[model samples]
Target: MDKAIIVFSRKGLFQKTLSAFDIRSREHARKLWPLVSFDESRQMVTWVSPSFENGRLRRRAHFRVLPTQTSYNPKQHFDNQENHRWNTVKESTEHRLAKELITAEISRRLNYGLGMPWRFKDKDVSNFPFLGNLLLGADRVVRLCCTKI
Candidate 1:
């Protein structure tokens, strides 16, 4: 199975509720309408296809996970209704659980494999000169074309 690393979003708590929906919706929209056009009236691009008579795209199905299936304990965490002090134990527990949930959901839906531990090193810095030469060549070509125009 392929290996991967899971990184939590900076948005913290809100990411839990929104991330799954966002991913599914984006994937569904991409599959349903490979190309989208902007509507001047709405001032935004939509998933509606020109081939469809109604110019409407089907809604994406929502994914739900029961609380019993995962270690997530929503009651232990703070919410807008409760003004409880921040607890590191609760935060860490929830964070870890969230990661597990997201990783499992992504794996199940997208057919991704389990995550593996890995490390990164800055060994590629030596290749900078080669990249710089390629960029310089492209810049020269662009300059030549601009001058000709």
Candidate 2:
């Protein structure tokens, strides 16, 4: 299986979006995280996984925004109104793309597991300090791990 680590800055869009969901519980927060990348030049947001293949580390793009789609720009209006409208459109577009990437990644993970049930084993929880709550109550762990994704 491939391994990946994604670190989102406190002020970044992903982090802010997660915060907006008001994930007060540790279990819920833990299950909502996804691995993704954004390419500025291509204006693409992609679901990616890093793996060791043939003795080399390779990054694979599982899902990505197409070039043609990324070129989207809001229609021009008056000077000030146009800039404001453009910013709004851009932010919304980015948010939508991020959500799509996360959804694709979650679906990929589920399919990759071949329909086996998700198990938050003790050992796995121990390795991740944020998941310590699982030790307190295994029953509290969210079964539908993709709820936020």
Q: Give TM per candidate.
A: 0.17, 0.19
**Poorest 10 consecutive residues by lDDT, candidate 1:** 140-149
Q: Write the per-residue lDDT of candidate 1 for residues 1-149, one digit (tens) a residue.
A: 01111112354421322222333355554443212112112111223212233676454333222233323233443362254333322446666677677655644543333333344446666533322221221211111111111
lDDT per model vs. reference: 0.32, 0.40
Q: Any runs in candidate 1 off by more than 4 Å, and if so which?
A: 1-7, 14-21, 24-60, 73-149
- At residue 16, what lDDT does model 2 achieve? 27
Task: Itemize residue pairs with steric clashes in candidate 1.
Answer: none
Model 2 score (lDDT): 0.40
Residues 46-107 of candidate 2 have per-residue lDDT tens digits of 23333568988675424344345443222332466766766655545666678778666655
TM-score of decoy 2: 0.19
Candidate 1: C-alpha RMSD to true structure equals 24.0
